[model samples]
Structure formats: C-alpha cells, structure tokens
Target chain A: MGISMENGLSTNKSVGKQSVLFQNPPCVLGYSSIAGKKEGEGPLGSCFDIIEEDPLAGGKSWEDAESRLQKKAAELAIQKASLQPKDIRYLIAGDLLGQLIATSFGIVDLEIPMFGVYGACSTMGESISIAAMLIDGGFADKVIALTSSHFAGAEKQFRFPLDYGNQRPLAATWTVTGSGAVILGSPKEVKKLPEDTNPTIHITGITTGKVMDYGIKDSMNMGACMAPAAADVIFHNLSDFDRKPDYYDKIITGDLGYVGADILKDIMKEKGYDISKNHMDCGVEIFSKETQDTHSGGSGCGCSAITLTGYVFKKMIQREWKKVLFVPTGALLSTVSFNEGNSVPGIAHGVVIEIME
Target chain B: MGISMENGLSTNKSVGKQSVLFQNPPCVLGYSSIAGKKEGEGPLGSCFDIIEEDPLAGGKSWEDAESRLQKKAAELAIQKASLQPKDIRYLIAGDLLGQLIATSFGIVDLEIPMFGVYGACSTMGESISIAAMLIDGGFADKVIALTSSHFAGAEKQFRFPLDYGNQRPLAATWTVTGSGAVILGSPKEVKKLPEDTNPTIHITGITTGKVMDYGIKDSMNMGACMAPAAADVIFHNLSDFDRKPDYYDKIITGDLGYVGADILKDIMKEKGYDISKNHMDCGVEIFSKETQDTHSGGSGCGCSAITLTGYVFKKMIQREWKKVLFVPTGALLSTVSFNEGNSVPGIAHGVVIEIME
Candidate 1:
C-alpha cells in the first residue's frame, strides 16, 4: 500500500498578488547567487549528475557559504542603492531552512533590522512583492530582499546528511542551490510606480497552494509530483481577478522539472485558459540541457530566488518583458516522508511583478 | 572570577532630538501580545501558548510552539492594526531555531510579504528599532515586529536537550517564554524620529554586548550576564549626549533579570553617572514571585516584548511616563556554547519609546 498524508491536508492552489497600482519609485539595486560547489558551473540537467562531488565539501560549510551569500547580497543591494549600513531601515529576506534561521543570524552583524521571509522558491517574487508593498504602503524609506541555499545545507536538513548515501529517484526534483537579493525604495519626485514593470503586474489577486498529494506511484517525477498544485494556483489566479492567460505577459512557476511543466500546460488548456504566449517554469529553465539531465528543474528556495535575480530581474530591467506572474512551488516534505513511503505533497504561491517606466 | 567587557562599548547614546520632524504617512495601527495560552496556544509565555507544557515531557515540539508563536503574534498585531492580511507589507519576526525555521514557516500561510529578523533575545527590540527606522525613513506603509519564545523551546535550543540531565544553574536566566508583536507604519502625520516625538523619550543610546566570560556565569543569571553591556550603553548614551541622569524621566533595559539590573546600577554609579530615580527591566518586571519566581525577572525574547506591550506601552498611554529610553538586552550564547562549558556573553540594543501627546 502507498503511504498517504496522515494529516489528509487538502491539496489545493495558493497564490497571492497585490498590485502597487502605478508607482515604481524603486529600482532593482543589486543581485547575486551562490551555487554550492557540487552545483557545477552550469545547471545540472538530470538525475545522473546527482553523483557529482559535493561542491561545498572543500570550502566553508553550507552555513558559511550561505552566510557569505547573505553578506554579499546585502552589500551589493546597499552599494547599488548608494546607502550605508545604517541608511537602510530594514532587510527583508528568507529561505527554505524550514524557517530561514541561517539567513537571520548571518545578517545580524550587518547592523540593520532584518525581516526574514520564506516562500520556498517563490521567495524572489515574495520578497519583491513585499518590498513593493512596503514602498507603496509607505512603511519604509528603503528595503532589501534576499534569499540563498547551499547544497550541503539543504542536503543535511532536507534529504540526507551530507555524509549519507543517496539515490536519485525519477521524481527527486533539483533545488536551485543559490541566493538572490533586491533593494526597493521610493522615487523623490512622486513618480508613478514603474508601468513597464512586469505587465502592469499588480498582484491584484492570490491563491495559495495547499498540502496536496495525488498518490505519486513513484518518487522520480516531480513534474507529475507538483503539477496539481501548480495548476490549482494558475487556475485560481486567473479566476480570482476575473483574469485570463492574456492578462500577464508571461506566467511563471518555480522549478517543477520537465514533467510538471508539461502537466501545467495541459491543465491550463484543459481549464480553457491558454497562457501559450508566455508560460515558463524556473525548474525547466535552469536545466534546459539533456546533459544536465536533471529529470526535473532545480528545486528548493533558491530555485525561484536565483532565477528571478539572475534572469527575470535582468530581463525586466532591459524591458525584455513586462507584466509577469511569478509563482514558486515547493513540495513540502522531509526525507523521513519519502523514507516512510509518503508521496510528496506540493504547494505554490504567486506574486505579480510590474515595472512602471 | 569576574566579567570583563571591552571599553566604551555601552557608552552609546541617542541621536539628538530634532523637534517637528516630518511624520511618515503610515502609522502603527494595531498590536497585541500573548503571554499565556490562547485558543490554540503553543509553548507558554509566547502568544501561542497551546504547547506550554514541557516538550521533554511529551508536551509539544519546539517547532510547533515557535511557529505558532509567530503566527499568533502576527495575527494579533494585524488584528490590532485593523489591517487586512494583504494590507500588511511584511512580517518581520524570527527566533533561535536551527535556521529560525519556526518563524519562517509560521507566517507562510499569512500570505503577506515577509522580512524574517533574528537578534536572539534582542529580536524584540531589534525588530522595533528597525520598524521605527523603516517608518521614519519612509520605506514602507506598514511593518510588523513580532517575536516569541517558549520555555521548552529555549531549554532545548539554548541550555540542555529536553532529555539531557545536566544541572541547570541559578545564574542562568529563563527564556521569557512568550510572544509579542507591534506594528510600525508611515504615520499619516508622521512624528519626528526617535528623540523628536513630543514628550519623546528618544533612544538616547545603545551598546551591543560581546561574549564576556564573567567566570561566575551560566545561562540563568542573564541579567547579571548582560549587566556590563547595559552599563556600556548607559554610559555611551550619557557620553554621546553628554547628559546627566535627569536628561529624561526613565531608563529601562529589555530583559535583564533583577541581578543584572542591580549590577547595571552599580556599574553606572561607578562611572559617575547615576540613573537611580527611574530605571527598570523586563526580566524583573514581567513576573514576580507570585506569578512565578522566575528567579530574578523575566528573561528571553518575550520578557522585553511583553514588558513593553503590557507594561511600558500602557504606562505611556496613561501619561504617567515620558521621555523614556527602552533598552532590550540579549544574551548571544548558543546551545553549543553551553555544551562547550562556555560562559554566556550578552548584548542589549536600545530604542526610545514615548507618547506623542
């Protein structure tokens, strides 16, 4: 018999988006990502590369690496904003350490008030969303958002002890082992929020993912593993605001690997909402090569954070895209669940990005 | 044999008062604290007290209690502020989990943008200081400062494993075992920065604590543990402003126990600064022999948080006090340190809280 979720939590869609309307006084300050040593220079494609040597093994512990990531990200954001340590009022950041403990302690020495946040891979959009809200809400003069992940750290906490043996199941999705940060503040001129921003992407709506498990027969395909939750959020986001696929320039989801992406597309079409113009998942984008051979895309909190920082933000700044919906998904399960014979349950949250030129 | 701290560490003082500073547009609307159990409480002292029983005795897990504390604190503060969940810009709260995982996951469902903060026991004050700064700096419209601590949670993380049979020391201070939350917003008619508020009690000074091995030390006597740090800030505040004890009405430290409070008075007197008329502490005030002998006073994140919420804040509203300095002290030792037989060192950050009337 397959193991079932004992809690029987309803697996549903979860996505929240609040629009800042038209104000874009803030600009992207700085961005950075740290790939654990084992994370090779390039993204890993499939399960076969899972056996690569531990990248963080030779250097600092994953905690140390993450610590460095926090400092670097903050420094870059602060420097880009042309602010001193004391100048920024708050640093809002988080990761998937079950509660972002490392990022919290690591930033203490920076001598700034910190707001730790977590949304699994959705953290990038989550941070930006909150930063935007803070800006529009008039709570802060400036705010910084950051997130990071080290393979060793992730492995120790989620899957196997750094020193333990592991196997790559077809369903075992890859977690983007990286960190990213952004800074936001007001424009002195009382200018409108960025309009060219991601598709007038005001988060006018949200539908959070729920604990869901549709009986994964195998642990190898996370696309299939997290498809339902993704579909749920995508479907809900559209319905909640009386929106359709055409509302956003692009609709994005955090790493869901190859299978989940296909499933999402299928689900969208099935629901009569076609987002064909632009529908992407970071999981699929990060491991586009067969050589990387990641059965799924990079997973973990860093998955979305790094992608948004490295790809989405840059793309947005260059006016390459506007009005994008960012939804980072997570399969909230511990190694014990897999070992205990539980099909992984999934959840995802979305935030819209808009830049008013 | 005795505690030794660096020179002039605590001599930090407040920034000068500037009357009629511009008020940020958003202002704090609501706040609440949970000292005991609520409907679905976690550990005692924190807002969520459902898990107050001993975790070692099979009561509840720290993760369970800690997460509940964060959620409850945020919820209460949100309710008090009369803001919708989406109306909040961020949830900035954190505690001493392996990765501050408790608070991170706790707010996952709240759906507001988040900024996780960690300053150990000082988290309470650190959160407020930054929230205030963020508001004053004009960064966001709304910011919530929340923190929580459970006795069982603290014991396992800071002192001993639930099952460990180590001899607890008297000097060791008990964690405040509670949760408190406050909201900072861009006031519609923003008040001047911290010392500028009418009848303002500016945070005259602040001194972060360093780990000093006062040979006679353990975790219990945290007030005693942090007395020196308090002395430094007291002196620094005096020196920074070159003011005497009569500069303001009151000076209060966050959660230094009775022992620490006494030591601070002595240390300040020796320095030719006498703040004898009005000085208080969270540790010594939150609880009494009748409430629970807590040895000397309330200690932990909740100590300062609750003290400010239940005592200091109400007192301000009552107009019985003005021009007060609120210093929230923290002991930075970790569970590893206790295991290594290391004496706990401390730090205290200060913020000036006063009535605008």
Candidate 2:
C-alpha cells in the first residue's frame, strides 16, 4: 500500500476534479510589470513599474526587446520581495514567441529551476496555477511566475511584418508589448519577512481549462476564437464552486475584447447564469478607444498579466476588492495550422485570488 | 493560521530542496510507442508497438504524419491500460515544432485537459514529471504524458527544408520520428486493475532541472550543447539523494548520443563520482553505427520517449532491471535566437522509476 498524507492541509480541496481549492494558499510576496510606450499611454499606464518608451528597449531585435521586458520584470519582482535570485527555488515562465525564446533568453541569468509552459495568451494563468501548486504541495518555498509578449515580435512571427502594414479587421486585437512577474512564497517563507510589509494576496484556488474548439478558424479575430473557452471555464468555475457571478467582486477575463465580451455574456446567459453586471476584461480596460485607436483592444500573453500585476493587484492591496476570479484565455493555433485549414482551439484557466486583511 | 493535519504521509519529501521524493509514487499503468521507418531498422526496432514503414504514414504532409504517430500511440496506450479517453483527466504533451503544432493538431480530437509544455527534446521527462506530480498530489486520478518529433518537420522549422539537402556535420544527430505516451494512475486507481495484468512501474521521485548554459554557441552539435546540463542534473540528483551511480541498474540520458555521453562521464568523474559503467544514452542505444547513418546517434523529443516506452520499460516489467534513472536533456535555443548569436542553454530532468512488484 502507498503512503497517504493529510499533511498541513488535507489534499481533498478539489471541487469536481477540475478545480483545486488550496487550503493553505500561497502568498503573493511581490509583483512587477513592464509595458511598452503604447501600453504606457493607456489608462493603466501610471500603475506599471516600468514604461519602456523605445519598442526595441535598446535591444538589437524585437525578440530581444521582449527578453529585456521579462528580465526587468523578474528582477524588479525579486527585488521588491527583498529576496535575491538565489532565494527563488523555481521560475515558471512563458511567452508568445516560438519555443518561448523570450523567457529562455530573458531568465537565463537567474539560473533557477524552470518549468516552461504554453497556453497561448493564457500563459500567465497557467504559470501562476503551476507555481501555486508547487508551493501548496510543499515542493517549493519561493517561485516566480512570468510571461511576456511583444507586438513587433508577435506580428513578425504570427502575421504580416510591420513593413507590410496590412489592415486588420475591426474585431482584431493588438498584441500588448509588456511582461509581468509575480513572486509566490510559502507561509513559512512569508513569516520570515519584515512585519512592516503590506498585507499579502492569496491565490486560493485554480480551475484548469480544457481545449474547447468551437470550429472558429479566424486567426485575426483572436477574441472571437477565445470567447468560447473563456465562457466554458467561467461556467465550470462557478458550477464547481457552487458560486454565482456576484460571488466575486470582479470577474476578469484575459483578452475577450468588446465583441467577444458580448458573446461571452450571451453564452453564459444560455447556460442560466448572467455575468454582465460584474464582468471586466483586461483587453477592454487596458486601452481607451478614443485615444488608443486599437480596433478591439489589447490581447497577448502580457495583456492580462501586466493588468493583474499593475491594476487588480494594487486594488486588492488597497482593500478596494476582496475577491476576484481571474480567467486568462488563449487561442491555441499556429500560422501553420491555420494555413493548413485547421480550425482554432481555445483554452482558459481560472485563479481565485482573495485578500484577508 | 493554516489548517494542519497529520494523517498519513508528510508533504515533505523534498531532497536538498531541488528534488521531490514522492511518498506515494504514482504507477505507470501502461505505455505505447510508434516509430518511423528509419527508427524501425534501428537496434530497438522490434520493441516498438508500431512501426510505420512510410515516412508519410499515408498523410498529406510530414506534420500530419507526426500527428498520426501521436494519435496511434495515445490510443494504443489507453487500450493497453483498459481505459477510455474519458477516463484520462489530463493530457500533458509537447513536441519539437514551433508552437507545439504537432501536439495540438495531433491530439485535438481527444479533448482532454492539455497542459502544453516545451522543453525541447527533454519534453518527455517534463511531461512525465508533471503528470506524476499531479497524480501524487491528488489533483487527478489518471493522466497521459506524451510527446512526438518528426525529422522532416523539425528540419524544416529549425534547420533547412527537406528539399534543401543541406549537408550536416558529423556531430549532428538525427531527429527520431516517433511518439511515446505513458498512462499514470493513482494507487487507488491502479488497484482496481485486473489481477492478471503485468507488474506496474512506479515513478518514485523526480529531480527538476534548471537551465544550464555552458556558453555553447554551436547549434549543429546539440549533444555538446546539452552535455553540461546532463552532468549538472546527474550531479544534483546524486547529491540530493546522497546516492552513488550504482544505486540504479542503469542511468539513461535522453539524447546525449556518443559525444555527450563521454562528456557527461568526464564531468561526473571530476565531481568525484564515476558513472561511466552504469551510464547508457537513448540516442546511442537506439541506432546501430554500422547499419544506420546517424553519426552521433538519434536525437529528438522522441528519442528518449520511444526508448523509455519501448525498451527500458519492458526490461523493468520483466525484472531485468529493478530500477532505472531516466534523464531527458533539452537544448533550449530557437532558430531566431541562434541567428541573433545567442548561445544554446541545456536542461535535464531526472525521473526515478522502479518496479513495484
């Protein structure tokens, strides 16, 4: 017979198997956000830790620019946590680039144990969930979860180059050039911190998402492609926890722009739950249409990541919000797959964060 | 205050804070492997579950052929375990292609909750480690860890297309066109199996690897690029567990091939432990020098995956070996990064598997 563990917390916090309710949630020790010029001009500009005016960020290429964003964000997060690079046991990171080049090149200097994950635009949520699991399961004491996306880099790889200047559809979303990093510490580790520190935000639970293919093949319209997946995860998270829309102070989605947000509301309405009143999307909140001229809004692995690190995280710390359900959605498709006539599939992961002050 | 319980096992199986020694390891219920024509003619040819003589495998493109390999392997693995698609709670998969298209397009029909991962050739070890952790942590009852790689597809993406006919260096390893899948189940789930089934292999522990860069810039020689990392992980595993090389019947490196195997031995020797006698590389064992033109032997995500599923696993089942250390090494460098003059970083994860009978 195998050994069984009740440990510090029972391992039976799973709700309906898709979600894990962490009995001893991991504390968010610190977080950092780095955004590009366009993102700096957006409404959440003042909240970012670093606003890089040069798209290249003094790097030789756009890919290298993204690497700089990741590096700065990670370094700043660790610094803010009053910890050195050696104190981190693991680094869970990813990016929108092929093979996660930005993350590999960015954090190579840290030399921490790395777990590279891919969830398209939803990588931030996936990274955070895995890092929390490692800490909650007692495998790690301190871990950092980070992701990044560069507009020029993603455009060159996934779509026409900047020189092409191809006109995008009205439903298309702009890839955010930014990076976000959050440091999660175990309770024992957090207890060693200074008593004058701010109250910590806890990741109480996570809902893993499945790839949902609604047979949408539009590569340009990522919001539409990811709406179904966002709806599915939102619906499942509520049903699994037996919660309603009002259970959370704010229900946040990664990128579903205005169009996709409406679509998600309709999808939820058909499922007997209406989330319209308390719904907010990072993509829609990031940019003001009148000034930004972004057709649909911002969408990328960095979109929700920076928003969380910059906006929601600060709100929770200031007691403006008690609880929030953060869902990051991803459109899982490659240019090759789209060129091959395959439809796009989408995925979304949900993380429940709460402040107990 | 956190909830505390001391029920069965302690959630503190960590060794030296770098590895996890599972108190209740997950069982390997079943595994399957599918290989291409070239691999079929290799030394371990007869051990594979299926061998597709045609490289195309009746598909329109090489990518589709790789997808077929994944589908066939997954189906056969589940069949061998007497389980259905619905029984699997998650599918952890990856490949050598950009964006993991081979895996996404390959296993989309299964509709399992997928955690797309990328560690290049070391993806197999990463996938298995995550799946085992999930099972041991009580997050899922059953999960399938799978990965694939195709020579043509990889060459076209990372190097030159098949039509280019580029001459490769002597140190260049051949990418193995194959796929492997392993079904991991919790103890309670495995206990429900029929009594007449063969003995199950248990994943007792895992040592997660960190990205190690030795400033190796030559992308063509992946074995040399990955050797330092292989040595780093092997050293850490030994130091963490306080065990010698003789602890297991064999210590297998994923795709170190002939050159890297020697380098790994020398590195281990300098660390005051000699692993020369017990070390075996999947890349070297998979192909015969005289028969196959693979200069340094086979290399790819499939190399170690198929070797583990087809060869080493059979030996463990028959009690030929009571225990083995499976280490898959990855060279993390994209063509874009390489072209930009970035050095290749390597990573290696060690998984200890033992027969529980």
Reference-based TM-score of each model: 0.68, 0.95
Give the per-residue lDDT of model 2 (tens digit) for B1-357. Answer: 122222111347566646778878889887899999899999999999899898988887788889889988899898888888877877999888778878877887887767889999999999998888877776777889999999988887888888878888878889999999999887777545543235378999888888888889987888888998888888877877778889989999999889888889988899998998889999999999898988988999999999999999988877889889999999996888898898888988889998886
What is the alpha-carbon RMSD of candidate 1 to the true structure?
A: 10.0
lDDT of 2 by residue, A1-357 (tens): 122222111247556546778868888988999999999999999999899999999999999999999999999998888888877888999888888899888998988878888999999999898888877877777889999999999998889989988998989888999999999877666654533234378999888888888889988788888898898889878877878899999999999888788899999999999899999999999998889988889999999999999999988877788899999989887877788887888889899999865
DockQ each candidate and list the results.
0.10, 0.40
Question: Model 2, A37: alpha-carbon shift in Å?
Answer: 1.2
Q: Which CAPRI category fits model 1? A: incorrect
Error of 1 at B92 (Å): 5.1
Model 1 Cα lDDT, one tens digit per residue, B1-357: 112222211111113211011243224455666664321131123323132343322224555666676677778666655566665554567675544545645666775544445556777766675556444543445667788777766776556676776665545566765677777665452334332122222222223222233543466667776787677766655654556767667788877776788889999999998877888777766665454645665677777776676556656656788656777776655543444354555655656555554
Scoring model 1 with DockQ, what do you get?
A: 0.10
TM-score of chain A of each: 0.77, 0.95
Model 1 chain A poorest 10 in a row by lDDT = A6-15
Local distance difference test values of all predictions, in order: 0.58, 0.86
